[model samples]
Target: MAKTFAIVVGESSGDQLGAPLIKELKKRYPDAKFIGIGGEKMIAEGFESLFDMERLSVMGLFEVLSRLPELLKIRKTLKNHFLQNPPDVYIGIDAPDFNLPLARMLKAHGIKTMHYVCPSVWAWREKRVEKIKKSVDSMLCLLPFEVEFCQKHQLNATFVGHTLADKIPLEKQTLQAREKLKLNVDAPVLCMMPGSRQSEIKRMAPLFIQSVNKIAQSIENLFVLIPVSSEKREKQLQEYLVEASFKYQIIKQDSISALSAANVALITSGTAALEAMLCKTPMVVSYKANALTYKIISKMLTIDYVSLPNIIANREIIKELLQDDATEQNIVNAVLILMGKNEQLRQIELFTQMHRSLIAQADIQAVNAIDSLLLSK
Candidate 1:
């Protein structure tokens, strides 16, 4: 009989990361039924999605609140369906908020569960490690440190490395990206990515655009590339950039290329900062969140660094200008410094070292972990 693997992934990044695992699993079990919530990439690999993946793409605390009923209904529906006919193993990729509870429900009913991508328990809410222990049989972490956290809690975990690391070249591969983007390879090019989320765009766009405007006023012939995740985001960023007197291009759905092509990147914190690091591009990571949220989170966080580049190195490799310090002057000075060959070379060397550490056949590692979980019972 063919095995069944139920996989749930939220957002495009999750989908991108999940696709390779699904492909590897298929290679091992040709007739296995791959079903759950996935995006286009997973669909291309013949995985069946029960509901529109966008249903789970809700962002922000307020946005999730508005969609709470629908989200709950979907989870309940999945819970009922799986209880009636459980898969051999269920895997939740990212979306810890949505996936962990569902995994917990399924696991309680004697179903095997695994989660890809460890949550932010390392940064804050360390008690969540206990909650996660009850949910999944194992965790497939993208970073080495996450596995260390999981080990401390005695949670079954593997450091599969980051899919971004696997995809991005280990060596500095900027020239080709610059050529493809039709950029002046010698001239200073800056990538300003505010982030993909609606909440991120709203909070950071003004600050980023104002910074770009001020930077452009002082610097000569500086070209900016802003990569938007969606058409909606493109429209939103266009409004912000139009008001700013800067030479910029609004590109859609090509964040990695933008990061690679630029001499220096002024970006919002999170995956993009990681991506910039993988691209071997120097960057200044910045973020601005709601005041009350920041205040509460500031107290909760255990770590000093925010960007993954800095966190991975266990030191401040890149400059992080966050919240109150994320001003135009600070960004301008940081960007100027990063544009210099000496500073750029320093970051690129460190980035290359980190990248080398992260390119460990992640897909195979993830599937092997899943296979072990499947075999245990």
Candidate 2:
């Protein structure tokens, strides 16, 4: 008999993480029935999504409230589907708010549950660990430090390494990527990645746009590449660029190419920072949230750092300007400081080691962890 596995991911990032895991699980169970909510990548891998993945992509605490009724309806539907036809195991990849609650409901009914990523409870609310403990049978962690936290809390978790680090080559392909992007081999190139979401573009895009002019005033022949995730985001940024004059291109969603070809990157603090680190690009990271959200998160945050590269290294390898400090001048100054100081070489040297440390063939290990869960059940 073929096995059935249900997987749920909250956003595009989780989709990226899910694709390879699905591929490997197929290798492990050739006739397995895979079902859940996913996006393009997972669909391409032959996974059936019961609902559109974008419905659960909203971020921030207050932002989720407006969509609560629709969300609850979807959540109830998922719970009912899994309860009626329980899979051998259900894997929730991030979106702890949605996934954990669903996992709790399913786990209570004798269904095995697994959570792919460890939530940032160590950094934010330590109380969340209890929710996770009751919700998941095991956690597959991407970062090394997260395993220690899971162990301290006595949860079944594995350090499966990061898929991005495994996917990105340790050797920098700067010249090849530059040639493909039609960028100057020696000219200073800046990749401005404000964010994938419109709310983030509204907040960070203007600062990045202003910084380009200021950065060009100091460095000769400066070129900027803004890799917008969607056409709507491109149109939104076009409005911002209507008043400014700069050497730039609104490239559509080849962030890896943008990061690889650039001499330096100005990015938001999150997974993008880790992507930059894996690509061996030096970056100045920044983040901003609404006043109320920032106020609440700022007080609850237990750690000093925001970017994953810095958090993993346990030191400030890259500069982070967040909240009230994310200004145009600070962006320009940080960019200039990085370029003027020749920071890429130092950052790349450390990034190579970090990449080596994280490339553990994650997809295979994650599947192994899942197989282990099956045996225990």
Candidate 3:
């Protein structure tokens, strides 16, 4: 008899994590069936996607509220489907907003539940710990710090390390990356990652472009590389690019190459900042949200920094400018500071250490953890 695994992943980063795990799981259970929400990568690895992953890829409290009806509809559909035909194990790979409730409901029905990428209980909504205990049968975490946190809370959690750390090399080939991207080897390169989502690009692109304009005025030949996550985002950024007066190139769906080739980066806070850190690129992280959303969520945050690099280091390794503070002037100042040799070298040294701590053969460990959960059942 074969096993069935239902995995749900909401965004691109989750998809990246899910794809490799699916491949490894397939190798372990040749006849296993995987079906759920995922992006291109997971689909390519023979996972059946029930819904377009983008439907649940929303961020910000206000944004989620706006789409609440639709999101609820999808969740209800998923819940009813699983109730009718439950898999052996349900793996919710991030998207805690949607996944947690779905996992809890399925768990009540006696289906084993595994949640990959533990939500930031240490950061905010510590009350979520109680819900997580009730919802997840086993939790697989990416950060080293999270394992201890989970243990303290008496949750069954395993640290699988970060898949990005496994994929990004310790010594990045910047020169070769520049050459491959047809960029000038000696010129200053700035990777502008507004974000992967349409809403994020809409909020941050203009601000990043304005900041780059300021930097361009000072630097002789600054080259900007904007990595668009999709054709829709490319077109969305193109609309914003029409107003820019600086030299820039748009590379579709290749954030790693852009990060590798960058001397510094101006990124909207999220996984892109983490990717920038892995590439050892100095960066100034910035983010914006709907005004009411920022006000409400900001009050609940327990941590100081937003970027993963800073959060992992437990210090302000990278400057995080948010909401009102994420101004053009602030971004320009941060970028200029990063342009200095001493600052760049310090960041790179710290980034190398962070990278070393996170290389833990994630896919294999994740599968092993999941297998343990299955055996206990």
Question: Candidate 2: which stretches are off by over 4 Å?
Answer: none
Deviation in Å, model 2, residue 76 alpha carbon: 1.5
Q: Which consecutive 10 residues in model 3 have the weakest lDDT in total? A: 227-236
Task: Indicate which candidate wins on lDDT.
Answer: 3
Best model number under TM-score: 3
Residue range 1-377, candidate 3, lDDT tens digits: 89989999988889888999999999999999999898888999999999999898899888888999999999999989888988989999989989999999999999999999989999999989999988999999989999899989999999999887898899866997898899999999999998888788888889999889999998889999998766777888999898787899988767889999999999988889889989999999999999998888889999988889999999998999999899999999999988998999899999999999999999999999989999995
lDDT of 2 at 312: 85
User: All models: lDDT?
Assistant: 0.87, 0.88, 0.91
Q: So what's the TM-score on candidate 2?
A: 0.95
**Stronger candidate by lDDT (2 vs 3):** 3
Error of 3 at 207 (Å): 0.8
TM per prediction: 0.93, 0.95, 0.97
Report clash pairs, candidate 3.
none
lDDT of 2 at 80: 99
